[model samples]
Target chain A: MAAMTHTETDGKQGLLPAIPAGLRAAAPVTILLVLGFLAPLLTVAAYAFATPRSFDVFRSFTLANFSAIFDPSNTVWMSFAWSLAYASATVVLLAAIAYPIAYGLNRMFGKWSGLVGVLFVFPLFVSENVRLYGWVLFFIKNGVLDGGLKWLGFSGGPEVLYTPGIILFGMIYVYLPFMLFPMSLGIAMIPRDLVDAARDLGASRFMIWREVELPLAMPGILIGMLLTFVLGAGAIAEAKILGGQSVIPIAQDIEVAFTYAQNWPLGSALALLLVAIVSGLALYVLSKLDLDRILGKR
Target chain B: MMKISRRNMMQMMGAAAFAGPLASATRAFAAREKELNILCWEGYNSAEVLDPFRSSQGARVKAESLTNDPTMINRLRAGETRIWDLINVNNPWARKVMAPAGLIKPLPRAEFEPYFDTMLPEFKAPYRWAMSDDGKDLLGMAQRFGPYSFVVNTDKISKATAEEQGWDLFNDASLAGKYGVQESDDWNVFNIFLVAGINPFKEHTEEEFKAFAETAEKIFKGAKMVGDMASLNQALVSGEIDLYMTGGTYSVSPARADGYPNLRAITPLKGPIDGKGGISWIEITSTVNNPELSPLAIEFLKYVQDPEVSHTVAFAEGTFNPVSQMGDPKCFELFTKEELEAIQWDTLEEDMARSAEYDILPDYDKALELMTAAKRLRG
Candidate 1:
């Protein structure tokens, strides 16, 4: 039986053909995962336990770096909570805004969809920093928004720049397209015949969408949520530039440790903690949704 | 006959595609014997100053700007001393920290004393703070010194009014949301102490700490925006905010050079201690402890003291500041009347007299914690 199994696996192939096709196809990505992702993570983990003052990992190990995270004086807990909330809000907001736009673009623009798709991605051509600053020009007091409002005879407008709302708006603006494209692709892949069949069965358009289209788009929504959440959680620029010091996220605290405080070990510890939290959350959600079969389809 | 597999063939094609640029990049990193690596502030490495030195000495100059003294000192302590040939930092760090750490070596007094002869009388004598504590070694050469204080838009508020109000201007409840704060945590602590009527140069009592924290919270709350030096300048120019806290010639000069002379930095007339309301920073150029590069470092110091080089360093790319070599006739000639006025040179002497030298605050860790907590409360 063993001989038969081996023969079947190796039949009509070269020397390495006994290796499964799936493993062979995944070899490049596995190499990248080890070298690019795992190596840096191990380095950061090693540094997190280094002697704080000297920054020498081999000389000694200490927990002072990790202990600093709980020090109320640092207010790291507050910053962490702020970052989680900021990222959660951004993901929810982007998903809500992108779905309709993506759906309309995919379904309504049948012939011109290609051109309109380019327009959707046009903002990506400009860098994130430039795009954030563009928002700054529009949102700053007495800026373009205020000028236009005055021209429209509005008076005594509220200041928008340096507010928390503007920061979230900036994050949503930057991440909306990331959510849109994948959702659009997922929707387009839904068979036209399935929706037509639902309509022919005396189901209304709303029922067709609610029962069939939304379920089919789950993979794209999940992918979009993960991407937007990670990027938004790690973002430092939107808060620093648009929201000012009023919005001090965990990234800013990590930056202060490395730059101002000159404490690399503490920064590493905080960064690793943040990574653990984000990755754990993502894994939990993926497990619940069985993303393997869904996102794996693409 | 031998044949290459498809994977091997593609690998070879990829290698061939990247070979040229990879080879050139490797060649580009070849070490130069005469190359000088400088870690200093923005103005020290401007093209106008570095190009001349590079041309004259036939050397390559690689420079990196430092954000703060502690970070740079920590980098050197972590074994970067071998890589950097020169260090330019505020005098206190050079005298108290770097020299003591043996991260930098003493300068040759004979070679540098001549340049000191041409400097302002205050800098003519090797200041005690610019030397090793034992006073046997000249630890650094002074240049690019200025009174660093908050700046205001002269169009909205008169310089006289700002100077008279001094630190009190920021504490006013009526001024809430009328001004901005520069996002420098350490500097903000010093400013808070100044506003709270406590001298930061000494260790603070519990009461003083509480007062400083309260003052910081109030000031932060009053600010409409807290931004970096660049954004603070923009806010002032664009009328987003009328003034910014913790600004100086370093923040306003670039705007002035760009034709916005209305921005003005104010040195207050009175304070809690000795009636001095602002801090003055004197940047010192010192040689890193690299024996091989010490000669080039000293030569660069001499080159930098030249009038043209001094002017260039003073008005370097990001911001313009007044240099210590301003006493030199040639250096004085480099600044046009408008340029000097933009720097507020007319009141330069008075501003200097009214300012206290920038000193290392005692127990900075505690101050940093308290200030950070205060900032967190601003949310």
Candidate 2:
């Protein structure tokens, strides 16, 4: 009788909460998620079938908007290619730069690593657009970079601003912090004893890093790559401020579609295509990674 | 009565107290008739033009700046006609697009037609292009207008050379990456047409389009930076670019006011299209379809025709240009000699003659697509 009573009490505690309690706990987040995300997505999908003549989705429906995407000469394809290229470049470049810095900071700085980490994140405090504008001053012809070069005895230098290379540099510069923080957190999470054990076993520094640190920091690498890729892929201001006419990516094309073309259906379709692409890629990535481990469920 | 709690009773009392004033405020807002909401280009939103009328009539004027006509027309088509009281668009859009679309109301002849007598001689009569196809309704009243072409740093490239070279200047490989292009697709499309020796104002043959594409592709390749007026001007002043393609007095004269007096606009003397070298844009101010705002719109029409207000419109902040109202002696007197020189007013008449008015392109969409493709190709 005592065992039965204890089992029943555990079931009551674990399986169910009071109706009001359950609602109160979930209501705010549920409401926020519905309003913030689902509504906009449904609206975008509805608009994808809407024609420009009427804002009401029910008034008109056409597949022309989707068909327009297949235009052989459409600049959107070029823009999409640029988006992928830029995002991939930024992700790989940032991973290379961020990994070393993160490892060094955690290993070398010891207890002072927090302050050093804060210094790395200092640029994030300033607005992204402001920082991009600052880069403009440095990158433009006869700008700070060129002036510095001239002062260093070069008469003139090649144009740096509004080039493909400068845009790549800007992507790395702006998103480096996002990559660094996650990687450092991952590095710090690796127990100190593991490193000491590797050292006692006479493992080379490079060998220890390759075998021990790299595997341990996989979660951080995944997180860093995901954040950096998504942020850089959807970048508009950096492209506008630094890329100029030299770089016209899909974000700019979507902007032009809405603002200049006044074709909401077309713009919506284009936007949906972009969302599909990014989501597909993200899902593929998540499939490869052990997200449960990253979330601490494992 | 309903056995309200203390909190509920306080809320009810508060609501009762606020409802009276709120109702009165709503009534007062609807009753205020002396209001005008205008959508116009950059130069027309100046307080110097709007303040006098606002103070004189005890009215409020809300003005918004627009970069192009299609954007404003698109807004109206999207049900913004009820919000905007008056609109200013280029002549072709007012006639061919807005009027036909019923986005704008026909102007009352007695109220608006007389202003043309005081305007430039070209506007003195009912120009067919400014009227509906059947020629019955007058669509809009004309005001601020000028020949829009290219601007160059006169110290770097002399006006004589710029005028003489015409569209050929852009074709020169020596000037490659030395000029900046603004990303006004319509304007650039027309410019490419001019460069390709075809008149964009008329129907274009496929061969002509091919030529235009070639020219546009080449022009895009030659440009170092493509941006708006601000960026182009910065590049010009910073010695990054010597020429600003598709610029006009509207872009250069403002910089003159800011001490960059070396910047000057040039309208070429001849081009492939019947020897016409540049395009003149005339802005037409029209009342929206809102019947309630018609009276206020009429008052504004008369107000803008006043020479002082016209002068303010010409020298509106961010840009300065010669207004058609300058034909009036009163308006002409407001411009200083230096200001006239800054706007290249001495050569204005000659430039005007050399230029043809901008017209509606039958295949504007196709042109936009071509230009866009060319831009991408350049990228």
Candidate 3:
């Protein structure tokens, strides 16, 4: 009877195709992605198509939200433009600022690099809002900088708070670490031997850097840019806390629609558009890269 | 050790999973009887306010605070009515939205009406906002209320000039870049309308909207800064801005409490809204129409009406404001001289009298869009 049971089990196992080991390993993460990420996105998409200002998600469908957003009279698009512009600015400025710092950490810091890295990361322990408020206190009239200047027998510090320039400054300040760490990793990945070999071949420092270092570091640099850009695009706190809502970012507009306006469909539509733009850019950039090589799998 | 087959193990796991939810359901059902859930604005949810009620009732009391009235009301509209036993929001929502939609239960008139007797004269029995539109049902209890308008550093812009100039302060081209605007959307919209010489509550013509759009643009353009209360107060203290629109007692009280008494909230002496130049907000705490409403909800309603609780609610969350019960000597005496000064108790009566009740704007969405556009344009 045991032999017969074993024979039946073998028959059943043979009839059912074997699952791929990779698929079996991926099951948990795939399920998590479906439940956690895809479900909320699908809900947002469904709501994006619902009636304007109505919570008839999944039950109704309309393009009124899209129409309103696209309408020339509607200036909501300016918010999106401002967000992308700020994000672009943040990426550019952070790239310039972080590249030098990242280089110094990798090339100049020696064994103290880890401690220096920790120093760079320390500010993140405090809430971004608190730190920005600290900046507010520093720059505010009769605040630290201004008061110090006054004590030193000078006019108070410049009115730097609540300007468009300060919004960009705050984004650059808040997202500096995001740009720095990835960039440091990228710079570290550049083999010292390759640089030495190029020097031995009489390659000038600039030539070696431009030809070898930049290309090799592209992956990490791109990752940092993407990270900072995405973060900056979605930034609301810097604008609120530091920029003083001088610029209404798209996120705040979306928030207002959902909160004060109680128009979920409109908010969802705005959110979906932002997600599409960001994810589209991300996908395009990701598609051009060899992630396995970047991740050291090769 | 006992050996179990793989099949038996799977069966046992499945049974546990099925039983887990059933046990949780049983526990949740049991908890409902001993739980009182409240949804309110910030002050009512403060530990200082809720801890006493929790101990007195010997029940689990939880409260959530949302800054926006429409957002909180929308939670009920989204079926959170089943979750909350009490909902406190600005006055109009109870009469204009919640009671009409049956999201909130009307209070027992005989039991709740007398609480108003001790309240401020403005909130006297048959208080319009606390009652249903038909004036038959008492929908909620009035509590924290104050005139909300622009605030100024009295040292930079004297209170007398500010009150007299009123909303025209924002319109003055010479004062451009000298003042700031707070990021309170509804209040900004109202102030923008007032600056444009249009009544915000009434329906408007396209021409009026055009004027509103222009005024919003000008205001955003002229502002030295735009921020929340704290930032505005800081700016005011530092002289970064002489004054800011969309501020009042609720926004300036903390600064006043901190000894920067020069940061004063000014209600304009006269302008639109039936010649009342300021907008005042009165919070109405009502019973939510939950399927299994806790009896403790009514007890809490009565408890907060007590002078001591009323005083606590007024000063809760670090932002000082006046309560309707201050008309009662017991409640009035609870406030110290400093506290009274912080809340600008001296001007409270006159300001309220000169202020129009904050109301639902007929064209708020359009105004919000225009305002948002103007802010972006400034950026």
Candidate 4:
């Protein structure tokens, strides 16, 4: 059989047939995937080192883009510090609330949890503009909640959109679904006997949860919270339209460079730097937590 | 009094039918062998404008409005060759972004002809004009101009004096969070120069820079940062900001026409910041594939030059400016030619004479850094 296959391969001369068979069929799809996914990013990564030399000759091996972003004028240090804090807060709040809802529905309702799932996921179908606008209208002085508060005798028009508290509210609102989905899926993996086993041993509810539920559910909580945290970290439209410039996000820096400033090299550098830093943090977190084992598969 | 006449109204509805057909009947239009795909905004070539051009030239134009020039430039940079025959480009975006990206057709002066003469020395802005330097026929014709000035909500602003200007909206006792100005370097650089009382056309002293910085500090201290017309308009209409500065009327006209009752505008007594005379510059340029179709496009381009359609676009669609000197001063089919001229072209020279030139394009990167620094400093 091996000799027969070798004779056939020798006849073919190491090339696939011209028609859509074997290598010919897969060649186009592989080329397309590589071109679509890798080429643009490679071009941008190349720009991270782009610098003018003599007569339009560019020497593109420097780390200058990364250094420039960290320059004092970029104010990236302060902005990113604040962004991390904001994201962390959003993750905590979203996870704290989303866990109960996701876990309860998954446990109590079984297949009917799908209806709750639809309700949770439905807002994703709406445009970001619609979501932001709804929030903007909700937080203004004469807005729905404000009017209700006024009717209930809240006297002040307290610049709700401009406040940090309101920003926290918005970040949570946008990322809760991210938090909920991952968390619910995580909780589903836990065996029912673990909780029942804890309870039957005469442990109180708090003791059972602290020992059994929290540890098992941790991976989901971590992954879910991480997704929310990352999304919140780079959040732009929410802070831009609704945050009222009282607090400008670092993403706005990217906007100014790309759009109004038209300085793409700088923008690309800044953005790529952000990617590097964020990815570094993510890897750090994942390694520390051993997410591969937690997820059980890659 | 509705400002739309019957015959023109019928033509408009007819044009709408043309639009719906064009989207579905792409292959049939391809058979016309005369279809031009233009990437532009809603105001640049509304059906009212393109339909007449199509009927006359047998060349149909399909315009797709983009978010901004830089975004369009990126699309073009990605080798968007056959997608667009004409596009709207910003002054600096065309210079720093588009032209540098090698996304152009290298148009020369000989082809532009009479419209070539129409570009004044100043109107021949930085980057697009560079295309002409390559010794080839030019690609695009400028459609409308953008004028940057202060606009006041009539309900809030009672004065229009020069002293009332000087970035004092940041200091106005009644308006603190209620007034807005743009956050970009274009606005920041000009506002600083103006508040420092330096003329951009002339040199600046060390004292001027300090004064500029000081007043900028003052203005930004209490001022709200505005991103664009959408943000400014929302605030302006919702009574968030009663007065705003450093904006173009290209996006402001219809918002005013909406008859907020509180809506009003002023050129400001001293003139626009640094007298750079920012205006919404709507122009058209043909891509390489459509170079042969210039006759048809130029014909359509000439139609756009007509004060009639220009006025309708500016006054109704919020893309201000389609100006011509020879047209009847009061006889636009849409806006009286007088109204059209007012919105389209006058602010450039008037601002140049009254205020310092606003040089926001150069040192743009530095300006961004400064603006962010200023924002941080404010915090």
Candidate 5:
């Protein structure tokens, strides 16, 4: 009952708590974000416009970058579409798998929520690469997954991580906690009377869940989902370590340009395109749910 | 009192900071036992010249295989000690970036002198760019050379006159859309210039770059896919691609071993683009800048070049035979005449003799720009 009240106790005080820093708070991070991610991007954008031999790097402007990006004969766009599809698949599958785990934690472990959360949180301690390597072992031909399935008479050899399925599993493993924590918090905070009221009114289990539990859990669900989607869309490491050339992602392609490919302006252009994609998503999520307001100080 | 004030003023102006800080960080490189580690590629683990030291010397060797450049650089940059005793790297990374980062140490002459002849001149060039101005400071050594050339799966192309027929394999009408080219190397982009018979260095205009791009656009017409050396090799073996462009067709022995009896190499008379082939500067550096391990590291360097070790690795790993053949006639018995040619960097040097040179490996900024552009183009 106390926790239920806590959920509705003003949308402020989560991430956007106000007291001292005010405008200067975001100033530091905003400046950092702009300088760190955007500054390089802006430089790249400038170069993308410059011709190969142009003297004035900043003022150079042309559409060759755009033309190069859109050369239909090339495989660039096809790869973008492929990554988008893969990321999308990752999100849908992750959400479905995570919701149950979130529910189990919220309902069964209210007495030990903090401890259980910590236990669930242990995977974060190791490096992302180590975790990806773990997935690699699990996915190899005679790895744990195949061996386990074979014992059960499933008879599958080439398992998930070696193929497209491995890439998806990596995405899910990384983002599952992103979904679970928030959804669990929301489920835990849902008013007990709501469930009881639906039962008393002779509502079916599906109806009670759909009309009652879901709409109220929407805030946590939306926040979790938005985060997971953004992470899925932005991931590069998981794909590179586990997917190889079999599953090329946009993030990996952007990385290869600066490192092995050594083309900065084009790397920048791809980066901007990625920003446009993620930002468009952020805006949509912001409009649909009063997330910032809910998250902001009351 | 007046003189004292003058002296004090002089001291203030000539403060200790005026004495330049250590040229780098104050950390010491002391000899420590069994504490450091190494990261490298699969070919880098050859046993003949290098691997014997691991057991006989009573030292622990933890070598990891990684081909991609970014991951290796990132791992080194992440500030972990006890990571590696050696990190073998390629140009222009060894010179342009990693050395500046102080992640590696300077190579000593004592360690380098014995194995010096085994290293070719191209092998010695990176040391200048990487270790010192003349590259004679001995900061690193070259283990293998991969020059740019083309390989054809004879099962696919079936050319009876390959050595004479040349690069028409790229534009052959029947092979259109059915062939493969490396998506790496901006130099390969200039291969289009070669097929069109243009010298890229003759005050090459944008027309040349575009002509190459257009040629590329045409060759790519109806193409099923594009990828790197690994992909091209896979395609050749799996019958997916008919022709492969690589650092060199030196893999002819192994390709032949794969039972493609008709496999052959065709380095064009006009030369393919600029030479992308050169040396890698993967020298082992110690955090302990000591007399013991330093000489031992050098000894290991010399010991590995002993023809026996080079022969063992060249056969096992399909990387080149790094030993100087004239120096060791006995090593000749280990490989066939054709196999010996397959491991020789001199063979490819003949092909690269007429071509212009572009340092595809440059400083970080240029490195990023070229690869980024290629990725953008590949995309």
Candidate 6:
């Protein structure tokens, strides 16, 4: 009878404290983030400190990999510089190219906007390498452009494939949609009455765009720029398939270290450095933006 | 409706419970005895090569192809030895790497030695790469070899000039921006050493290293493009490039077979390594050191030695190559005129004579770093 009374008292107190509903709801995504994102990142971090050229991650720790990268004799820094330069150029070029198309989608497409949007996204379903190779077939000597031109009594197509310029061109072509959609959403977010109000208040076309439209659409534009820059910085295929390795991006260097060199520590260090740069830039931009407002939260 | 007794229903359930595991165990035992798994380079995994063997042996055969030899070797190192029954890679790995690592088991000498006698003369009995370094064990079987050097359009740079000029052709200032470089790191390093008049196989002094670096930088900077075999071949066909470095009959055979006979892989008449200017890669297929070693492994090895299978392997996957079995008259007769021309059969012997066997370089890592640095500096 005493033992039964003790069990009753414990039951009344509850075996465990109740979990908050919000925490319960977030359990799945939180677990996913920990397992998928955090675990791999931690593994990479552990590898970065491993002995150079060795797979002794966690068992051994040394700064040798970082030292090798920091060594003055290493020209891997040039690859990093090239990758960053290309990424920056890609962002600027895509901004220029996607803006007009994005504007037309918002202001002109009407109810057909979704269909036009699908056309832009259609190429994404095809493999990136296949589409790039199609470009290769089109641009290559005696290829479609050259053959067609020659048949029409023209000299031939200009030599454009397999150059640094073409690498940039390929990146812009590939990342255009990443820039375009976000920018379209940003432009669409602007209230039409505000621009009209600015115009009625005796503002010039440029002034209205500057004071009302640009600031309002800045969030989407910022997201687009961030997306393109991050993706461009990690670009590898464009340099290989299109540029003909005219330039070795940092990603290729990291790949070589992992594969041909069999230096997992060095590869991890290189990857970590790239991640730091891209993540630092991303976090800085993301911190400044009102994500709640951008995402349509009340 | 008639009602069944509970006891009868209980008996049926008890019998099913007892027999289910027995059936599964029997199936598993049968599957284990008949299963053969292969890890190899691309050609050996093709349906043309595997399907007939599967049907003949009544076995369940599976294969995975990887492009890089080191990557496949590393997979074995990472505990995949238990999963694979057979492994086929370039020749040196068997003698130089895999044998030392114990990733593969030696074949029976009496059974496998006769196959070598039927192979090309270069792969005659006691072939160095197909044996242990101590010459006590038969390591593997050799097939699919060619002299890899550089290729050119015979129309622009005649084959004679290419052979005569050799590595010096790349040094000529006029050829800058005219030739493409295949992005094969190992072959590129070999070619760069040849260009620098250095033997890549030997350990190099600091001065030789400096020379290698300079040659690498110059080669990368001078080339019109650096790309894969398909891209380089396309560029060659399109007239965008006159020649490409690190090519062979293996890389150019498809184009040649497509009626572009002017495109030819050139083996230089002279080189730094004992006067051989070209590197040839021979593949060796060996039994993996799996705990459950399949009996079918040796049977399939012998099966591929047959003339029709050899011909099928040579032409598998759209890339044409000459197999060592072609040295046998029976295998030679299997080739059609077009196929013979495709593999550049006319020059195979002479090219092989002029080429050094591909081997592991003592300073490969250093050379790769220098090569990678040169590539980056070019960027």
List native contact recovery per candidate, as a fraction of 1. Answer: 0.55, 0.45, 0.84, 0.27, 0.07, 0.73
Model 4 misses residue B249 by how many Å? 2.6
For candidate 3, write residues A81-116 as lDDT tens digits.
999999999999999999999999999989998899
Using DockQ as the measure, what is the rank order of every candidate, best first?
3, 6, 1, 2, 4, 5
Better structure of 5 and 6 per DockQ: 6
Error of 5 at B341 (Å): 9.9
Off by over 4 Å in 3: A1-16, A20-33, B1-17
lDDT scores for all predictions? 0.82, 0.81, 0.90, 0.60, 0.57, 0.91
DockQ of predictions, in order shown: 0.51, 0.40, 0.76, 0.18, 0.12, 0.61
Off by over 4 Å in 2: A1-40, A51-57, A73-75, A103-134, A191-203, A288-298, B1-36, B43-62, B125-138, B291-309
Q: Quote the lDDT for B179 in model 3.
A: 90
Candidate 6, residue A75: how far the Cα is off, in Å: 1.0
Tell me the spans in candidate 6 whose CA falls farther than 4 Å from its real position: A1-15, A20-33, A36-38, B1-32, B55-60
Candidate 6 backbone clash number = 0
lDDT of 2 by residue, A174-290 (tens): 999999988887887787899899999999999988889888888888889989988887877766667667877788777766665656777788888888888898888889888
Chain A only TM-scores, each candidate in turn: 0.84, 0.87, 0.93, 0.82, 0.78, 0.92
Expressed as tens digits, the lDDT of each residue in B1-379 for candidate 6 is 8677896688789899999999998996667678899998888899999999999889999999977677788788868998898999888999999999999999999999998888888889999988999999998988888889999999999999999999999999999999999977878888999999999999999999999999999999998899888889899988889999999998999999999999998999998999889888898999998887888898989999998999999999857899989879999898999999988999999998999988888888999999999988666
Looking at model 4, give its docking quality level: incorrect
Q: What is the DockQ of the complex in model 5?
A: 0.12
Per-residue lDDT over B1-379 for candidate 2, one digit per residue giving the tens place of the 0 to 100 score: 5888896788789898989899987875674487788999876677878888889988878889978777788888878887788899887887788888888888877666677777777777576556777788888878777788888898899989999999888888999989988867678878888878788888888998899889988888778878778777877887888997788877778787777878877899898658898988888888888745636777888888889888888887887888878878989999998789768897888888888888878887777767777777766
Cα interface RMSD of each candidate? 1.6, 1.9, 1.3, 3.8, 8.4, 1.2
Candidate 4 chain A least-lDDT 10 residues: A51-60
Q: Looking only at chain A, give the TM-score of model 3 against the true structure.
A: 0.93
Candidate 6 docking class: medium
> Candidate 1 on B189-296: residue-level lDDT in tens?
788899898888888899999998888788877788888888788788778888888888878877877788889889998997576898888898788987556356
Residue B168 in model 6: lDDT:
92
Better of 2 and 5 by TM-score: 2
Poorly placed runs, candidate 5 (over 4 Å) = A1-209, A216-224, A235-250, A261-298, B1-28, B32-42, B45-51, B54-143, B159-165, B190-192, B200-203, B219-222, B247-266, B269-297, B312-327, B335-379
How high is the lDDT of residue A235 in model 1?
A: 84
